[model samples]
Structure formats: C-alpha cells, structure tokens
Target: MIYKYFKECKKLIVLITLLGMLIGMLFFITKDTPPTLVLKKKKINIEYGQTYYANFKGLVDTTGMSKKEICYLKKNVSITDNLQNEDQKSYPAVGKYKIFIKYNNKLSTIQIICKDTLAPVLAFPKNVDVIKESDLESIDFKSLIIATDLSPLKEIQIDTSQIDIHRIGEYQVKVFVEDIYKNRREKEFKVNVTENKQETTNSQNNQENNVNKIESENNKPNEDITISQSNEKNNVKDHLDNGHQQTKPPQMVYWYECYLCGLYVDSNVSLEDAKKKFDQTKCTDAIEFSGIEWRHSRFHYGINHS
Candidate 1:
C-alpha cells in the first residue's frame, strides 16, 4: 500500500510541474508585446482661424488595453508642435506643421495643414462723381477705399476701363483686391461724368461790367446843369428847415453770390431757391458762398465752402 501511494503522488507532482512550465512560457512570450495604438487619422486640416487641441480625445483608441496601460498612456502622452500658444489651443498662423505625439517611448506623427479660405473685405462708396476732362492721374483711388484682410495685400487694382473723362455719361468702375493667400475681393461703383460748363466766366464778366459802370459814373463831368442843381439843393435845405421830415429809402441787403453759378441773391431769396440754383448749375458740390465784403476796386470772388 505505501509503494502504490508514492507512485500516485509522484505522477501528480509531475503533472503540476508541466502545467507551471506552460504558464511561464506563455507569460514570457506576451510580456514585451507593445499596446496597440489605433489612430483615426494621420492628417488633419484646420482653417486659419480655427483652434487645435493638445489633448484631442477620440483620435487614438485605448480599447482592449489594460487599466494600467491606459493610465500610463494617458499620463505619458505628449504633443509637440510649432504653435506659439500650444497651451491655449489656438493656431498661431497659417502654415503646414508636423505634430509629434509620444507615449510610452513610442512616437506618432500627424500633419496639420493650416489653410486660409476667407476672402478679403472691401468698403467703398456706391456712387462717385468725376468732373469732365478731369486729370485722372491726380485722382488717388486708394484713398477712396478701405480694405482689410488677415494676410498682407497682394494687389489693389482699379478698373476704369469704362470711364471716359472727356465724355458726359455714367460709367461703371470696379476695384479688385487680393491678399497674399490668393483670397480676392471685388467692389463696384457708378461714376458719373458730366459736362464742364464755364460757370464762373459769366459771373466774372458781370462783375467787370459793373465795375466799369461805377468808374464811368465816378468820372462823369458835372458841367451839364450846375445852376439848376444848385437851386434844387437850396430848395431841399429850405424844406428841411420847415420841419418836413423826408423818409429815407430802405437799404439793399445782399446775402450771397456764387461766382461759379452766377447766382446773385439778397436776403429776400429763400434758402431753397439758392439750393435749387446750386443744383441746376455745373458747379461742384464743394462750391458755396459766405458773407460778402465790398471793395472799391474789384469784386470779391467766392471761395470753396466744402
């Protein structure tokens, strides 16, 4: 009976030893195997003004990983890029950048291409007026526009192909602008070209005629009827001494006179009438009249009241 019991114990011990060896081999075979890192994509595209996250979740999957391995990856994963504000999640500028993700001594790379899809902004008037036969070279088109963009401007072109300075008609003008990123913007406005009438010539001529008439009156001789004039003056003095008060005529009051339009008006003229005359004339909107001053020599020309 003792011999039989020893034999069974020896067989049981051998079976247990073989089972332990198999388990050891399995552990050794799988010990150095790395955890799989499944990535959704290896490349990402973001706009110029978009934000990028440092700890972007769902980009890598941690499924089938042990609790310890997942914790290690979460703690050890790091992302590096050329962004200035990497901690703030905003892209610095528009360019292509390579992002390095490292976890557990393994590195993964992703390409980020920052692109600009927005166009430039333009602000300009809808209607413009140009004088006929104007000097086109003196006109500064840039001063009349306001352009804005995130990138530097590449070009600003004014298309005045339809405009004719010598012609009296309306034309369409276009302004085209572009940025460094190939973003473009276009704006259009109407330019009116009108007849260039010599409006100030008539006023100047009228003033010259009035001056000549005044000079002639001042230089006129008093030899025609001197005795009759003296008698009339004596009679007027006698009438004044007799306590007869002679009423004086009201003084003429001139308000404004536009040299450009030959519009001469007194205080009796309404403001609306002056505006109508201004509109009817070929004078520019900048022309206006101010307080008048009298001179014995020449007329005071009106100035620009814009």
Candidate 2:
C-alpha cells in the first residue's frame, strides 16, 4: 500500500508541472505581440504662430484580447484620442515636437521632424535728405537719401554706426539699405533737372559772371556825373506835377527810373506805386531810357522784338 501511494503522488506532481508550463506559454503569446501603430503623416514644417495636428491609425490581432492600459510613449508630445477609430491619436503644435503611442506596457517609437515658420521684419526708413536739381547738375542723383534698418533682425545690423547720407545726382544713387531678412538692397531713380543742356550751361555761366561783375564793379571808380541845373529843375517839377509827392523828398530821375522801384521814371504812371513792380535786371538798362521821351515808349522785351 505505501509503494502504490508514492507512485501515484509522483504522477500527479508531473501532471501539475506540465499544466503550469502551458499556462505560462499562453500568457507570453498574448503579451509578446502588441498592437501596431500606423502613422499617416510623420513629417511637418510650420511657422511659429501656426497650429497643426499629428494623425495616426492602429490595429492588432486582439480578436479575443482586451487592452489593459493605454499610455503615451512620449511625455512631451500632446496627444488627443478620438473614440471614433479603432485606435486613435493626434498631436498638434506650432513648433517642433515628438509623439508616440503605448498599449499594455508596449510602446511605438516616435520619429517626427518639425520645421520653423517665421519671417524677418523690416524697420521704417529714416535720416532722410532731399536731393534737388542742383545735386544732379554736379552729378546724377535721386529725390532722396534715406537710411533703413532691419534691426528687427538685430543680428543683421552688424554695422549700425556705418549708415550715412550720400548724394550722387538728381536721378541716381546707391542707397544704404537693409531688408526684413537682413538682406542688403540698393535702388536707383531717374529725374531730369533741366531739359536743355544749353539753358543749363548758360544759366550756370551767367550766375558765375554776375559774381565777377559785382566784384569788378566794387573796384571801379564812382562816377562824378552831375546833371545840368535846368535839366534837374525841369525833371523835379515834371515829377511833382505828376503826383510823385511823398513825406520824404520827391523822387529824382537819377537814371530815369522811379527811385523806390525800377519802373519808367515818367509822369503818366503817377497812379501806380512803381516801387514794387521793378526787377533789378531791368535796372541795368537805365542809361538808354534816361530821357522821358524814350522812357515813355511802350516797352518791348526780347532781342528778337528789339
């Protein structure tokens, strides 16, 4: 009886060991193959202020299996679950970030590439200087010289102190410039100061000649010209009768022109102020019209008409 009992106990122990092994194997088979994650779009490039989302789909042979715990493979990436799909996950961000999925302690690795999306900004131009026709006469230049910066791209303003004002001509210049992206830009313009070369040259020469003439006039002797007494008295009476009377002494026909103005110093224009209507250029023709008769002749301008 003792020998038979020992033999039966050894058979029962062997059967229990085999059953334990089978149960362990079954547990491992279910746990080893986790659900697979399928990513729809893995790479994204976006701007700083933009919004986006990462989409995905997943599946498994969990025909009779149930998910124990769902977790994220990555901690930083934001994940949103959509109950509509069998396996659902989404990640979105304006900047670059990574994401992953986990089911039942098994995780799917994350491989994502995100790009930056921001544009550089340009600053308002300053230090403006006007470019006139005279500048073009010396060379070629445009309407203005303006200073610009992209200090908004602070690194690009490497030579901030070097910005300067320059003039080349009326219609062209090399502008010192910087763009929003720190790019250097130069612009040119075309503006005509004068249409005719002859007129420009003549006007320039006339200005120079006038300066020389003034200098020479200063060196010349002051004339001791004296009018005959009879001429003076008659001229004085003629102006007085024509209403040249004033708080001060009556005007004299020094060069046959109104003293206050360069108009004809005659009797008929007594009604006009005569003081304001005269140009100094016409004053130089004083000697020819010194006589009342010639001064009274209707004035005709231009060498062609003369």
lDDT digits (tens) for residues 83-172 of candidate 1? 553333323478778778887778898887888777776665455555566666665655656665546797689988898888878788
lDDT string, candidate 2, 1-306, tens digits: 999999999999999999999999999996775444444444434432222333322222223324441232122223442212111212233233555545445554444443322333222212222222232232212222223221233333222122222432233323444544445544433222222233445576668768887444444332212212223221111112333221222232212243323355322232122222322234433334113221211131111100
Model 1 regions lying over 4 Å from their true place = 1-35, 61-73, 85-91, 195-306
- How high is each candidate's TM-score? 0.49, 0.26
TM-score for candidate 2, please give it.
0.26
By lDDT, the best candidate is 1
lDDT of 1: 0.56
**Residue 202 CA displacement from its true place in model 1, Å:** 6.4
Query: Where does candidate 2 have its weakest 10-residue lDDT segment?
Result: 297-306
State each model's CA lDDT, in order.
0.56, 0.33
Locate the minimum summed-lDDT window of 10 residues in model 1: 297-306
